[model samples]
Target: MATWISIEGHRRLVEIIPNEVQELWDKWEIRGLILVSLVSQLILIVLGNRRRYKPNICTRALVWSTYLLADWVAAVAMGAISSNLGEYYENNHKKFSKYYINPQLLAFWAPFFLMHLGGPDTITAYALEDNELWLRHLVGLLSQTALTLYIIIMSWKGNWLSHLTIAMLIVGIIKYAERTWSLYCGSIQHLRDSFLRTIDTSKKIEQQQESNNDGMNFWEFLANSIQKDFENEERRAGDPRNYLRAIYIFVSLFADMVLSPWDITQDRKELHDRGCFHWSTYFTLVNNELKLMYDVFYTKAFANYGIQGLISRLVTLITTIVVLASYCKLSENKEHQVVDQIITYLLLVGALLAELSSFFFAVFSRWTRHYFRLRGSATFCCILGCIIDCFFTKSRVHISMGQSSFFTIICNKSLIIKGNFFPVNKLEKLSSVSHRLTSEHVLQKVYRSLYDKSERSLQSNLSGVPGYRSLLLEKNKPIFASEVEFHRTIITWHIVTDLCYHFYDEPSYHFDPRKNSKEMSDYMFFLLVKQRQMLPVGAGLITLRDTVIEAKRVFEDINVVTQEDNLGEACRKLLERSTTIPRNEDLRMQSTSILLHACDITNELIADAGEYRLPMWDFVEELWVQIISYAGAQCRVDMHAHQLRRGPEFLSHVWLLQAHLGLLDQFQIIPH
Candidate 1:
């Protein structure tokens, strides 16, 4: 009897719960979905702009989730509405007057979903890969539009609400089309093709030949034109217009397009004249330019420019207003339910607010300023600039460099009692810390080094530090200068830098080259361990692991207390070990462990500084600049573009600056 009663109770629950859920879903499904869609739009408009600057993992994840959810919710709502209209039509046989819930209001909701699918103007592609899926978006546009049209046609009552839906549908299509076009235009293939079409190759060749005969080259003439256009006081360096123009000309570099000799010559001359060699000016311009490019590739900045963009905006605004007015007038008729009327009003108000917000972003956009200047609309541009200055204050780019130290990693490992049983690689990653604001002094030194090396070809520039190899050979330290593998060299130098940092007395001045070298060393190690994709393909993992194992063994033998506070003692202990290289050790065998080699380098640097009365930190600092710049120049173009979406990398800035300065192979033609 007890078992039978339990079975009967289970059966009742199974039947009752599902029926209750089904009834609830049937009543509130469409209403719940539409509300979700509205809230998503609000979230996107408020948070979309944050991703460009804030690259924290949590921030990006939140924005990414909302970006995807907004589209999915809008699409699902449309399908739900379509299903409801189909059911009503099949059951009632097109008898609109007898329906309890008006089908026309349901039709009115369909176009709002279409508008939601259009997305906010602040963001279009969440990642660089999203821009390549333009064809998928195009198909979605067609299918969703057809589905919306079918619903509207099924519920046609030839009334004010139906007419309002038509007007809204037109606006919705325009907005959706704009997003599709933005993705298409941002695709690598399309951007390259468009760029090629704009270049008059035949004319360029003719000009080149004629100028060659005149003892001046085509590049010189083009350089003069750039000066005339961009070097004026009103459009001088640091101007957004200059950055826009530079982007227009140099964006092709991102597509891996080989620039002609004339192009490189023209750009190098123009950049130099613009004082791009000044470290502050160079970084600021590059940072601003990449930020604009991010806007172009990932946002609606490209789509909402020029006469076409203006006309679309005007049409969208007019139709949205007209539809809102018509809805208010129709609400007076009492043909729709109070609940449906309220929901419709909420959607309309949301749409209007979204449109106005989009317009505001577009008007103050750098793209808009560029467009107006190009059209000679000085008055409008000036007015917009004043309005922008009044409202928005420019914020500095937050540049944080990742720092990972071998000494820190080794010293901190003792905290974990499991030791070798635990994953040391994970510990290394966790040990890495990031410092806010890369040193301006370091950047200045790097700029000076690169500018000095710009006259050399890419091969010669990256073939070891410019002038340090000969000096090392003179000191009989050839092995340090001629390390077989780049990764080995990085590990060797990083250990040497850590030893010097802890072993030596602190420098008197705050901006000493010693401090700068130490910071750069840590940053490079960070890249080697974490962001190796931005470096050349190599056995960095093997190199890092072997070096770590050797370091652990050394620490164990010495019985060093491996704690963060005892890091200096640990470094000094390592330095006290024998600095002699094994007599018969093969260079290849030496790769097994670089710790002793690093000790030798540290001694040689200190000895050289004392003997030659030269600043050892200068050589160390410049060597790091060469290593980092080589890494930047060697990084794949696609990887560089990919990092832009995440946040600006120092390496990407260096890469762009190298291209402009004719230090990369992309600038194929060497001007005489």
Candidate 2:
């Protein structure tokens, strides 16, 4: 009779809690949730303190950190309120049962925090490789936060958290093993290959100098040659682009090596993201992906809309707030609560099916890459293949990424591009040649702005029309002294897009056509033009619009600076270094150049209507110019922002200049 009464009270507690739970919010469990939230918030402050900013930090850090900081506090508030329900239950063991979903909500929130933890931000400028320690610590923090929340949530289901401690231990061990495998695949061997090759080239130079019996040492001799080679240098024989290419080769190679481990990661994430999108399309692809495992997928355990996975993470906060409010609304609409249940059941089934499909698809994707591509990242694909083999045959849940031989299936993940071609090893299509042909207007306008007699030099080069092979080889010769500076910015984009979006080509992104790019492309043909000269301009334009839009959207984004006070430093840099666009014509000409390059390459790639037959040098020039204009903008923005105490203040100068250039519309400035 006593136990029955206690169970009845425990059951009744669910009805009483939400209304009265706020009374005892300072209890241990509530305090624990608050501690977790506080810790998560601190992590953001610390990350910011570390100054681990990537090239595109504005979008990744500011946006993601603000969201995490705000939502984390909200999660804590929910936890505190939910924990107060313990007072209503007569049985101590069933104390927190009313708040069964609270910890689950926290788990659902944990992943978003983790996802943003080490996103796209660079720990170092002019470098592509992320520090291993940073990555490991981030992984540890993410995994621990997720596991702790999952344990608390799953505690209510069957107190399974206590037992799964063993499973967690095993997973941890396997993950460590996976990390070791990754380190090997992204070995430093490839990056050093170029350095070794360069050193050997230098060695030959040294030997030639040594055999001369000149009074100079190896260093002196090399310096002399470099100086002598620097003067009146016409047809650069060795790599004029060497210093930059050397740095870029390492940056790209290192980034590539680090990312190679992600082939397996890409496969899993690709499958997972695909599953999320699958929900949009009524889960048809997800269903087809895992139709064989319907029995495992159709389990009653997953009969809840919010599960501890990717999809739930996306919808959890808003959905939870809605449901909590609906608790009050549902009293009046009690009949409709039944409808909510049915709809939830159906949605839960869809989510479960999607997850089940993803895990399974992740399994086969590795095997397919392994058996077919034969570019083995590890043996785990084989193991995963076997596990899937057993599951299909036995009708049981044998889901595991480790069933494969290696941990790298994530690296070859699919992007969501609906293009006609299949996924290639590294998005292998180069920007085609005709793309180099900048706008005709740009060619006409260059001498009119920068120099007069220089036009004769530019026109001669423009008309020379070097063969595609010769010009392509010419690009390997030389560029500006800061080629490393240029390459770093460009490769940084490669890492993020490849790692995050799986390098999906944004075909719909509004780039100007080839005629437009021509204005910019002509700059490449100038006597001043050299190899890999366009990266700075390319990355800059890439994110300029986003920055302008963000600044407009936020009230606080407006940085108040007088000419000498706020905008002076930036104004000086723009003036001195020529980062400025003096007139709208200058911009229009450049925009035309970018369009010309874009159209030319795109046409060559598509053979779309095949109108223009741009020579090869012209083609390469267009591509370089397109990338350069965008990259140059990024490098300039970075340089400006680096000298500031506050970033917005630094960027505020860009706006001032944009106004000067008559690009106020592009910068979106409104009058006070």
Name the Cα RMSD for model 2.
23.8
Name every residue pair that clashes in candidate 1: none
What C-alpha lDDT values do all the predictions have?
Answer: 0.73, 0.29
Considering summed lDDT, which 10 consecutive residues are worst modelled in model 1? 213-222
What TM-score should be assigned to candidate 2?
0.27
lDDT value for candidate 1? 0.73
Cα RMSD of predicted structure 1: 5.9
* Model 2: residues with Cα > 4 Å off, grouped in runs: 1-252, 255-672
Candidate 1 wrong stretches, greater than 4 Å: 1-17, 93-101, 201-242, 274-278, 332-342, 385-398, 411-429, 455-476, 505-511, 578-591, 610-614
How does model 1 score by TM-score? 0.86
Q: Which predicted model would earn the best lDDT?
A: 1
